[model samples]
Target: MKNKTVAFIMAGRRQRRRRWILVTSFLALLACALCCAMLLLGSTIYPIQDVVRALSGENIKGVSFALNTIRLPRMLAGLFAGFAFGLAGNTFQTMLRNPLANPNVIGITSGSSAAAVFCIIILHTSNAVVSIASVVAGLATVTIIYLLSRAKPFSVGRLILIGIGMQAMLNAVISYLLLVGAEQDIPTAFRWLSGSLNGSQMHELPALVISVLIGTPIIVMLGKHLSVLELGEQSAASLGVNTDLTRMVLILSSVCMIAIATATTGPIAFVAFLSGPIAKRLVGVGFSNAIPAGLVGVNLVMAADLVGQFAFEVRFPVGIITGILGAPYLIFLLIRMNRKGNL
Candidate 1:
């Protein structure tokens, strides 16, 4: 009986692993398709051959200029930034074991936005300065929220509450900056604040790309520890996990990726908030959802961008479309959580 039970358990495990692999693979392929759509389905639709030729450095008149100059950067911006937000968002949700603990709800994005706005309006700094300031400010905001949440015995609920408070405060500051900003700067600041992918140049991509590349491996390498951490701090420690070290590393890596993505594209709405749960639901349970989450983020941003570009009478920002999608889900999640007494 014991042997039979062991065999059954092993078979179940194998089944789950297979399912995870298949689902994750599907998500990856979907993301790739969305990326292709982003590149191919703009105002003047370019054929696949033209896109391929243009990508290969062939100067095919209008095709080359349009693809190389405009669409490629936009696609890349959505791909990398979406991946960053998704990965970081999943890390936070998994580590904190709360759906509400994402960077979006926790003021991390708000912190970066406030800093970027200040740079744009008051300081009138360059994009580089704004990016740097936003990163520093994001890191600082997380640190502050973490410190404040560490009162006596730590509480996830307390941390979330504090984060929400911080978000409110930061938003007020952003409004004040807008009010005092020069008329010319207001449009620029508003555009950035709206979390747009417009005018995304290739030059502005390296920092975000590098951050995602570096941060992703670290997060995935620590995936097992992250899963263990989700079992509560004391339980994780008892299982020989260094909860503090793991938590800190995860937070830092996540914050860095998210901050850089925010700097690159202005905190594309709720990609961080919505990616993890969606990935978790799609990929199911037996493995880490990080990769799938990132892929889902990529698909969401790219698909949303495509919709914004062509779905309406006028082009809308990617963020606006995502917000429209995410807000209703947020409301539903809150109601469900409240009903379950988890809120």
Candidate 2:
């Protein structure tokens, strides 16, 4: 009997590890393929060799100019921003054990968006200043939400509800900012509001890239703690998880990633809201889905951008495509959660 139990446990562990490997590899390959397509499939498509050569710092006429000055930055922006949104969104979902507790749901992106729109319209700020303000505003908003929602028992429902209210208020603020802005600034503000990579440049991506590079590993490393966190606060505390510190670290790291991503891409709709559940459903239970979620995010953003660019007579921003995809799911989730009394 003891031998049988040991064998069963071992098999379960092996199976879980196998699933993780398969899911991670599949996501990685999918991301690479999408990235290659982004680089090679634009108008006046360039070959792989030219793309490689341009990446290697060589000048190859139109190919070099196009790849370096255009495709590369756009691709990188989607890749990094998607990863940030995915990672951060999944972290929130996992930590809170609620599918609706993502950054988009909880007003973090809206907070960033409101600040950026304000900077663009009212303050007449540069993009750099707008980005900084967006990040600061995102952090501030989350902090306020946390304080307002923190109770003796720490209710996830309260946090989510507060976030939703904050999101609505911030969105109203954004509309007012737009309403009062100069006519000349409206176009730029509107484009940013829609969440675009239209004018993405290499120079504007450093903060996002750096945040992802620094924060992703930390979150991935804390995946075990996050899983423990999902087990309820008292249980996690009993298991020596340092609940408070872990939550703080996860929140701060996730916020930084989402804020920078929002600043760069204008809150890209529902990438954050959709990535976690998809990754989990693919990867299954018993394994961390942080990296897989990020990769899924990258794939979603890149693919959605492609659809927006070529699917319609009118080219929509990436956010519109993602928004269309996400809205139905959000509605379904709300309905299901209501039925289950998880709301």
lDDT (10s digit) by residue, model 2, range 110-223: 999999988998899998999999999999999999999988788888999999999999999999998989999999988998888777899999999999999998998998
- RMSD (Å) of each candidate, 1 decimal: 1.1, 1.0
lDDT of each: 0.92, 0.93
By summed lDDT, the worst window of 10 consecutive residues in model 2 runs over: 63-72
Instruction: Give the alpha carbon lDDT tens digit for every residue of 83-161 in model 1.
Output: 9999999999999999989999999999999999999999999999999999999999999998998775568899999
In model 1, the clashing pairs are none
**Where is model 2 more than 4 Å wrong at Cα?**
none
Q: Provide backbone clash counts, one per model.
A: 0, 0
Which regions of candidate 1 fall more than 4 Å away from where they truly are?
none
Clashes of 2: 0
